[model samples]
Target: MSAESDYVTLISSDGYSFVVQRSSACISAAIRRMLDPSLGFAESKTNTCRFENINGLVLEKVCEYFYYNEKHKNSKDVPDMDVPAELCLELLMAADYLNV
Candidate 1:
């Protein structure tokens, strides 16, 4: 795992597991702080990332985006891919989660 912490378990609405590293999970600032705070970081009761408004396919797209970003954090030479509408929604959700 490329993350700096333990593996995180993101659970989907229909009972799906999205295992991700702390670094990859940090892609969403919301979950980052909530799950692993800089100070007073504690274990959360949640074992999942509970996307109440997002569907499976869209969440999958968001996970794909996270993977891509994590895989190419140092490479600025990559070209942009055509983003789907659902992905836009997922990004919005991420922004909302991060409260940015």
Candidate 2:
């Protein structure tokens, strides 16, 4: 794949955009499907995904979790990710929707 295609852009509901490594983002099954080239989805063609129900703040944390998951995939002992209390519910809902 070309260097540009190695990354994907995730856009939040409120118009925020986050560019992350494709491999890291693919840790989420939903994302993996959305970006699959053979699927011929619009997201696959543009390498961009937009979450309608996920706001920018929540999506940012989701992206962080993606990287964290990728980094600790093979390790037994991993540090806990810091999550703000107020966002717990929203994050949980997003995680469920994303199937992360």
Candidate 1: list runs displaced more than 4 Å: 1-5, 37-47, 98-100
For 16-87, candidate 2 gives per-residue lDDT tens digits of 999999999998899999999888788998899999999999999998998888889999999999999999
What is the Cα-based lDDT of residue 62 in candidate 1?
65
Residue lDDT tens for model 1, 1-100:
2224467776666666678776677777767666754443443434345666656665566667677878878997976745777468666775576443
- Measured on C-alpha atoms, candidate 1 has an lDDT of 0.63
Global Cα lDDT for candidate 2: 0.92
TM-score quality measure for candidate 2: 0.92
Each model's TM-score?
A: 0.67, 0.92
